[model samples]
Target: MRLALAAALVFAGIDHWLTPERYLPMMPDYLPWHLPLVLFTGTCEIAGALGLLLPRTRRLAAALLALYFVCVFPANLHNALNGLTVDGLPQEQWYYWLRLPFQPLIILWTLYAGGLLPRRATAVAAA
Candidate 1:
């Protein structure tokens, strides 16, 4: 699942890299260096996706993936808060608002699948 999430993120990052202008307005006004941000995130997605496929690095990759989500969250917030638009997405605030709740679900899945989340001790005790 983390691998799948990484792949999906790669696609999303590529979209941002491919069209920085479209995403630029959504980036937090306080942030600096859009070019590096776009490039670094694109590279991170690709590297993280590959890392997730390797058992030895899966945990670290998932942690990074979770962090990546947190890092990019401001863009989503900007979109929702300022009515920013993107291609291939519906131009509606409702759509952006609906996207907020998905962050935790996706981040949790990434961590769980990558084994970054510790197994519950209660489950072990019960067994």
Candidate 2:
């Protein structure tokens, strides 16, 4: 799960750089320097993703990545609220609405994958 999450983040970060305009609509109008912000967040994502691979940095990376998800949530909300489309692709309101609840799941996943969460072990019965 940890490796998968890392790969996903790396892919997403790359996407931000490769097609930044696709993310522009998600940015709130009040935010300044949209392009730079996108690049910065993208870089952070990539860095965090790489950090996750190292045992010493996994916890910090997980925490930061989880926070990143929280920080960017408004953009997700903005996309949903404004009925924004990506690359001229129309997305139904339900699609965006469904995504809102998944943010927390992603956070939890990161924590668990990073070993920051307490693990429960099942007791084995004596044979």
Candidate 3:
């Protein structure tokens, strides 16, 4: 799960770089330095993804990545609320609404996969 999440982040980071314009609309108008912010977040995603692979960095990476998700959530909310289109793809209101609730799940998943959360013990059958 950790590796899969890392791969997803890497792919997303690449997408951010490849088509930044697609993400521009997601940025809140009140925010400054849009392009740099996009690039910075993309870089962080890539770095965090790579960090997740190393044992020593895995926990830190997971924590950071979770925070990153939290930080960018507003953009996701904004995109959903405004019915914003991206890369010529038109999304329905329901689509955005559906995505809203998944953010916390992603955070919890990251924490668990990164070993930050306590592992659940399996029950053993009595002989």
Candidate number of the best lDDT = 2
Candidate 1, RMSD to the unseen true structure: 3.0
lDDT of 2 by residue, 4-103 (tens): 9999999989988999998888899989999999998899889989989999999999999999999999998998889886674557778887888999
For candidate 2, what is the lDDT? Answer: 0.90
Model 3 TM-score is: 0.92
What lDDT would candidate 1 get against the real structure?
Answer: 0.80
Model 1 per-residue lDDT at 121:
67
Which pairs of residues have clashing backbones in candidate 1? none
* lDDT, model 3, position 38: 90
lDDT of 1 at 38: 71
**Can you give the TM-score per candidate against the true fold?**
0.83, 0.92, 0.92
What are the runs in model 2 whose C-alpha is more than 4 Å off? 88-90
> In candidate 3, which residue pairs clash?
none
Q: Candidate 1 residues 16-60, lDDT tens each?
A: 678767666677778899777877778887887777888999889
What is the C-alpha local distance difference test score of each model? Answer: 0.80, 0.90, 0.87
Write out the backbone clash pairs for model 2.
none
Off by over 4 Å in 1: 118-127
**Superposition TM-score, candidate 2 onto the true structure:** 0.92
Error of 2 at 25 (Å): 0.5
